[model samples]
Target: MPELPEVETARRGLEPHLTGRRVIEVRLRRSDLRWPIAHEVRELLPGQRIAAVDRRAKYLLLATAAGSALVHLGMSGALRFLDAGLKPAMHDHYDLLLEDGRLLRYSDPRRFGCLLWQGPGTLHPLLRRLGPEPLGPGFHGDHLWQLARGRTLAVKAFLMDQSIVVGVGNIYAAEALHAAGIDPRRSAGRVSRARYAMLAATVRDILSYAIERGGTTLRDFINPDGQPGYFEQELNVYGREGQPCRRCNARIQCVQLGGRSTFYCPRCQR
Candidate 1:
């Protein structure tokens, strides 16, 4: 699945083309994705001007006066900006035809992506209870420390919680924890404030770097420009089990924590 950085990459690529552009055509090649494509999307999007293109967690928000469109690029979804002359291929599911004769195309080989709608002054349930954005100012050490208090969950699991911090998925969580020199197996409540502070900063730095590099593309992820992100080349411990650690030269280790793969350097992270 596309995490926050990957999703943000898509948002950045789409924002320039989508903002202020009127939707002259609404073409739905299929009626469903993950869930049914809401009827409001078909009816409200066309002729409405796209006020802004924003991202909350991994969802892409297309805003207009009439309504807002919420898009989730499920596991294998990729959005492409195609010329009007280009034809839709096998997995191309949704298209937002702009007055500028461009198509914001959504293609998901797995059909897990979604198109939903929201009305004015209302928040979608999927987005309502999400924690603060990891890249936002609200997500510093003190914030994470407070939420981590009295939690017995492993630090990796706690960090992955949506209510504690949104969008630090498995890949970035492992990378951030590794960067902070914190063991993924530590109890969340037992982690010191100092370590948490370092962890938070590491998370921000890693995520920002990934976004700058256009996000890590392990599989099936591409920016809206159809370019694969190169951040995967910079991973430290996520997929390098048994490899030498970059910092300590210790063997990178792996284990299953909370059913997700966890990786770290035993000698470096304590």
Candidate 2:
């Protein structure tokens, strides 16, 4: 699935082509994607000008007077800006025709993504209880320490909790914990406030840098312009199991945490 940086990269890439442009048409190639594409989306979207493109967690919000179009690019999904005359591919599921004669197309081979609507002033359930954006002001070290109180979950699992902080997915979580010198299996409640401060800073820095590099391209994720992210080339430990740690010369290790693969340097990340 596309995580925070990848989703943010998409938001940036789509902004110029979408903002201030009116949606001349809305087309859904199928009835559902992960869930049913919103029934009111087509009816509410056309003729509405896109005011902005925003991201909350991993979700992308397309602002319009009628409502915001909420998009989640699940595994293998890609959004591309194409010429109006461009032909749709087999996986192209949604299209927003723009007044500028361009089309914003959504293609998902696995159909796990979503296209939904949020009525004005009403927060969608998926977004209502989400924790502070990882890149936003509300996600400081103190905030994380507060949430960690008395939590026995593994620190990695705790960090993955959407209610504690949003958009620190498996890859970034591993990188952040490694950077902060924290073992993924440590209990959240046992982590000291000072260490939590370092962890929080590491998380923010890793995510911001990944977004700047166009996000990690481990799978099908790409920017809206269809460019693969280059950050994967800079990875330290996430996929380098058994390889030498960049900092300590110790071999990296891989373990399964919450059913996801986690990589860390045993000597460097303790």
Q: Which candidate ranks first by TM-score, i.e. highest?
A: 2
Which regions of candidate 2 are displaced past 4 Å?
Answer: none
What overall lDDT goes with each candidate model?
A: 0.92, 0.90
TM of each candidate vs. truth: 0.96, 0.97
TM-score for candidate 2, residues paired by index: 0.97
Judged by whole-model lDDT over C-alpha atoms, candidate 2 comes out at 0.90
Weakest 10 consecutive residues of candidate 2 by summed lDDT: 26-35
Please identify model 1 stretches exceeding 4 Å from their true place. Answer: none
Cα deviation of 18, candidate 1, in Å: 1.0
lDDT of 1 by residue, 1-270 (tens): 788899999999999988999999889888678999989988888999999998898899999999899999988889998898688898999888989998899999888889999997889999988999989988999898999999999999999998888988999999999999889999999999999999999999999999999999997788888899999999999899999999999999999999999999999899
lDDT of 2 by residue, 121-143 (tens): 99999998899988889998889
